[model samples]
Target: MATEEKTLVEILEENNLIDLAKYVNYVSASQAGAIATFSGTTRDTFEGKTVVELRYEAYVPMAIRQMKSICSSARSSWDIHSIAVAHRLGTVPVGEMSVFIAVSAVHRADALDACKYLIDELKASVPIWKKEVYSNGEVWKENSEFMDRKLELGKTNGSCCRRNVKVETHGTKSCCGAKVKVADGAAAEISTSDAGTEETI
Candidate 1:
């Protein structure tokens, strides 16, 4: 007899706009009592600067791989039934969504926690890079999650298990023991990890 998989994970990275409804529907199941989601959207202003739009680039293959790993980790930590993640590349206008995640579980806690974990880990560990474009000028912004992870790596001398995660830092030759170059005119994507509070429905 063939053994069934314990959890189902779905990941997508594309240059086209993401369809939130599709993901929300995909993770919905009869057995799932709760569905938690995170939608990362572009904001209008940053640091008091007028923003035009945001740009995102990723090492697609590696990004998807890391996302899968994060999903697996979430499954191990929680009794999640399914997960669906989608990230948009290219240009995402202000007030538009850049990333979306959905998680389903038998209970609300597992769904909510796994949804949050998926986004946080994705921001912290994934190789996707974001650039913020302002009216006057533009700059590549680093996520707080990424910066914290970088600092933790330095403190442990890159000896930690999560040290293998590579983060891109501005004006630096190395991040998390990996070399990277910061590109100019880069816009900041979604940096807030909270994604609002969990809603029961």
Candidate 2:
């Protein structure tokens, strides 16, 4: 079985900005033919509200773990070379990047799709939460897409796939939609289905 280890996941400290080039450079590989990226920035407005900024928080340890699992899942699903993901904490003004992702692969399709998957999964499942601050007030927000994904998971597999299940090395806990193998100092993806009854990393 083939495995990749070139993955970088970081939750930036308070007031630290995301370095766009750092991640892109990390994923740059000689064997890679394509590089894809996604940047989540705070917009100036939301639903007729004048936004001032956005604030983010997270359980740092678990956030990094979940991010690694997500990257591992992408590697199993695509032929990718390297992956990089970064998320910002603290106040982020409008037009500033809050999240950035970079993916490199031997083909454009792999990089493109993996890039999309990384951001989607991060937004939906990561421990990091965000609050939107408007001119009038501020409120913590949840991703609606994540809620939808949870409903879908409930309809198909059990709650294990959608909720944050503690991943055990040899124990009987599953993961978020992917069969993750926790071994060799990394979380590697093995399969995508049968997550309800089987033990996933």
Candidate 3:
């Protein structure tokens, strides 16, 4: 099976704000009237304690799937021409860019909205987990307090797993109507009846 690879905008090194800005600029070219960017950096404090560094790990395939889904959704919802999202794994120091999201659009509103949505969805859905290595101790914090709050507020939404789902492509009743049923059994059977009343299985 082919697996999706992971990519990081910056390697696990010292913080470089200029590189982040340059990446954003690279993604957002002169064709776009507005460019929206969101950069998440390591914080100096966590849970009222001083923090030093953070180690991030991810299920590479799943993380890539989630990111691609985010980009697809943004493209469908907003009039955006380009989008780039990159998150770092491995050790990240305090005040270093952990994730970067950039979106470009013909107008500012769609770009900004899509950028914010991309970041929020990435935080909530992406499988990248972070271990906060405090100056005192080490603790794995998958989602931050803000993410927890968002979850509590019921703002997180998206599909994170691959499940069988029936998708309607157009508003028209397919210009036709067809029904397919999958029965649950030891050897499940999927029955499909087409609009032409033909059954070939």
Candidate 4:
């Protein structure tokens, strides 16, 4: 299958609910020995403030492009089968999922690792903005991962990211974690990460 067919990316319209089963089944394949998933839901509170809902907005074309790039990055680091990523727009009430990712591979490790990479990259690089509505008021929010990526980019001048085995990209100007040294038109990537370690990017 082509890349378009292998990877499913969607930005749900307003008032639409993400069908978890649809995504779960999308990555299911006979060759896949493992299917890993991640669901990001809105909680009832943040910093002790009661949250009414989460509002999201994104540049759909750019978001999809970035998501596809992230999926390709995951595949570059691991042996993967298929990837499906979805995010909600408009409003997301507390306890409802706002973002979801599903990845499949031949081994548990590959699927698990790719799933982590997909969500992390989506947060770090995708052109999605969020707002948190509290019972009293609403405030715009920026993901910590997104902020960290900005810091990382400021520290480097090169383009094209390659996340390292440690899940920390060095010498990379890109927001997505990747150890790429772009000097004199040369670049390299660090593939994979320590399974025992938690994701940082």
Prediction-by-prediction clash tally: 6, 0, 0, 3
Number of the top-ranking candidate, with TM-score as the measure? 4
Residues 1-201 of candidate 1 have per-residue lDDT tens digits of: 222223333323333567788778778887888999999999999878887777666644455556778888998999987788877665677998988999888899999999999999988877666677767655656566766786766753432222242323333221112112223332122121222111111
Please provide TM-scores, in order, for all candidate models, with all chains considered together.
Answer: 0.71, 0.73, 0.64, 0.74
Candidate 2: tens digits of C-alpha lDDT, residues 1-201: 343538877766556678898778788877888999999999999999898887776555556677889988998999988888888766788999999999999899999999999999997777666667767666666566656666766653533233342322222111122222334333232222321111122
TM for candidate 2 is 0.73
Please list the residue runs of candidate 3 whose C-alpha ends up more than 4 Å from where it truly belongs after superposition.
1-18, 144-201
Model 1, poorest ten-residue lDDT window?
A: 192-201
The lDDT values for all models are 0.65, 0.70, 0.59, 0.69
> Using lDDT as the measure, what is the rank order of every candidate, best first?
2, 4, 1, 3
The positional error of residue 3 in candidate 2, measured at the CA in angstroms, is 14
Model 3: per-residue lDDT, tens digit, 1-201?
221212222222222232566556555656678878898988999879887777666544456555777788787898886776766666677878788877778799998999999898888777666766666566656476435645676756523222222332223111112222223341132212221111111
Order the candidate numbers by TM-score, best to worst: 4, 2, 1, 3
- Alpha-carbon error at 131 in model 2, in Å? 0.9
TM-score of 4: 0.74
The total of clashing pairs for model 2 equals: 0
* Top-lDDT candidate index: 2
